[model samples]
Target chain A: MDSLAEELIQIKREGAAAVLATVTGADENGGVEPGQKCLVRDGKIRAGSIRDWALLQAILKEAEARLKEERSKLVPFDIPGTQGKAEVFFEVLPSPPKLIVVGAGHIAVPLVKMAKILDYHVTVLDDRLQFANRERFPDADEILVGDMAETLKGISITPWTYIVLITRGHKYDEPCLREIIHGPAKYIGMIGSRRRIKACFQRFRDEEKIAEEVIQRVHAPIGLDIRTETPEEIALSILAETIKVRRGGAAQSLSGKQ
Target chain B: MDTIYDQVKEFLDKGETVAVATIVSTKGSTPREVGAKMVVTAWGEILGTIGGGCGEADVRREAIEVIRTRKPRTVRVDLLDDISSDSPAVCGGIMNVFIDPWWKEKEG
Candidate 1:
């Protein structure tokens, strides 16, 4: 394979977010040609055929925005010195979203399984090895056994990460929430009853002085209003909520509301 | 990890010219979103799918031509004509797919 193709495969396998910008149309004498491409990863041009320095910089800036939104589109770029315009298609390859299930309980087993089915990089964590073993979470990418909140410190929390706080109790869930409440996780969900969740948020607001907006970001009493009963159903509901958040869906039923 | 690029890489490394067909833009009610891709080999074998039915078959025919000629072309697939038919590609939408030729010599 060519070096650029090989590099693209490596970037995808490593689950890195990158953008492939291809020039699809160019005005005559534009100094760019159709089918030319540049691969941008981590704000650097790792490979491709585009050569103009000015165009590369412009493409890099636009590529960053596309990667951030995780959307791909055909964009137009005007040449630096002329009326020539180059139409570039920016294709965003987002990394697999990480689903960290923080409590290897009954719900977690099904949650990990469902998340794996959805192609998430699933990680299961617990304070007890007996609960967080390979037997319970065979498909999980990482089975971590440690103090849940402390272990969270070791994991890199990016905007692609989703944290599901389903620990044994709110005593455990709250501390874990504190560890990541200010971090960059795209979704933070905690399992608890309405009353308990209210008390927990009150504590976070009054004692910890956590900002109200940050505290409100947590999806307490997590999952959609699906009236789920079984463990598998609950897992499905939680994942459905996560998917809604990820895809920006309307979260409405197809059957219509009567 | 299962990108059409992976399949394209495999074909190019074997010294074969492959046609990479991508759904660059889509209208309404299509089966798949834009950026959906499929790789067509010189022997007319497909690695992925850009929806199915007549739209794919039409693209496959054009993809074969793209492989033979080593030239990229855009195909406009209209599903509105088959809306009353039983074809699965009849989603009442139109999409423009760009079929590009990729080989070992082509960089980026």
Candidate 2:
């Protein structure tokens, strides 16, 4: 691999966001040529051979907008003070989606394993060091042992983060849910029985006065109703629900009997 | 394990240039969504797929040409016309594929 390719692999491994700009077309006298490229990370040009002073400045400015939206596109740019009309394709490489599993109990063991299989940046946390150790979660990216709510408050949550609350009981899960309920997580699912979830939402709605829409966002009684019995089956259902939420799928039966 | 970049890196490590064809944008009902990619080696071997059928074949031809010239170009693939083809990939949509050549020389 070349230095650029090596850096790209490292960037992906670290799950860093970046934009790769490639000039696909340009006028001859425009001082920019096709196939010229530049790599942008953290609002600066990190690599690539696009060395034109004006073109680099233009690309840096446009790359920021592309990275902000996390959308790749074929964009046309007309450089200032030059007759350079070029079409550059900005490819946004967003960070991988993260999975934060709170309360490393029985369900969490299989949940963490499945999330890792789905290529999530899995973080398993619990109050008990015995439960939240590497012995059980060998594939977890982070094994956090601390107060569940406090740990959740300390950790950074992004739109790509998926939080699962499968604590020992409602008392443990409630505080953890409160910490991340208003945050920017993409999906927030709490494991509990329907009656327990209803009482919890009632407390949030009446006592705390949390909005109905806000409480509605929490996927309590989490997981698709596939009549899950075992921990592994429940874990699979939860992951399937998260996938449905993330990818906008209609949860129809795929029994394939038809 | 199915990362196209990893395969591209492997080909580059072997001193063989390859073309990375990416569907940058699509209109109507294409088989694959935008950002679907296929890596075409200089020997016309493909790693991933941007949807199979006549459209992919056209892109493969252009990808090899991109590798030979070591230049990047965008090929507009029209899947609207070929509805009678045997391949199930025809979805009556138009997709713009950007074929970019990758090699060791482009690096710093």
Candidate 3:
């Protein structure tokens, strides 16, 4: 294999995020010609070609825009004193965001696995040591055993974090939800039946005095309504919903209705 | 078949130029949905399948071309084309494939 292809494979193995720039035209100096590729990571030029300093500078500006947009496309530019259109391919490879599944119940198992398969960094948290073992969640990046709320105390939830509550029961779900609801997680969900959801909302409304709007943020009865019955199927449904919410997609199902 | 990561790593370790074809989007009844990946090496060896059959063949050809030219591209393959006469597969679907080639950089 060529060094370029080899390096790309290495990047994929290490799960590195990078930007690839390809030149499509060049000036009289033969710099920044068509079909040249460059690899950029962490704001630094790693490899590939755009030989001319001016052309590289121009490509960098366009590369930054492609990275911000997280898009891979041919961008056209005109080199100084050059007549031809300099079209270069700018491809951004952003690391997959982390998805923290706060409960390691039956639902959490599939969710963690599915998230990993989808290239998300997955962490499975549970107070039960047996349930939160590596054997069960081989794909998880981390498995934490402790009080859900307390364990998450020091961990700041970012805009990229995905928090799901599939704890053993409502006892664990409510406290965890109460704590994380105000955090910056991009997606939050709790698995429960209709009655359980109603009861949890009542407690949140009456005892905790949590506003209805805040409670509404929780995706109770989590997962799309595919009438999913099995743990695996339910996990898929929840994942679909979480992706929809994260991608700013409408919450309504493809079958229509919320 | 080897896992996506394993196959990709193997190709890279061998120092072969490779093109990664990811099924970024799909419509109708394509065999594989989004996120499915296929890797094609410079020598025409394939490590995975975006769907299989002619659809995969077309992607393989395109990936080889990308590797030769060191260009990253997205190609739309129609699976519903007539297999017998004009086109490749008749799967009755379409897929948008992103073909990205890997490269090395000199660190200063």
Q: How does each model score on lDDT? A: 0.87, 0.85, 0.72
lDDT of 1 by residue, A66-119 (tens): 888888887889977767899888889998899999999989999999999999
- Name model 1 segments beyond 4 Å from true: A252-258
Candidate closer to the true structure by lDDT (higher is better), 2 or 3: 2
lDDT per residue for candidate 2 within A92-209, as digits (tens), equals 8877889999988899998988898898999999999989999999999999999999989899998778998999999999999999999999888898887898899999999999
After superposition of all CA atoms, the RMSD between model 1 and the true structure is 2.9
lDDT of 2 at A18: 87
Q: Write the per-residue lDDT of candidate 2 for residues B1-108, one digit (tens) a residue.
A: 335677788888888999989888889989887778899999999888899988999999999999999878889999989787766988989999989888976753
Error of 1 at A257 (Å): 20
Task: Name the DockQ score for candidate 1.
Answer: 0.60
Residue B17 displacement (Å), model 1: 1.2
TM-score winner between candidates 2 and 3: 2
DockQ of all predictions against the true structure, Cα-based: 0.60, 0.42, 0.18
TM-score, first chain, each model = 0.93, 0.76, 0.68
Over the stretch B24-60, how does candidate 1's per-residue lDDT look in tens digits? 8888888888888899888889888899888999999
By TM-score, who's the top model here?
1
Error of 3 at A63 (Å): 5.5
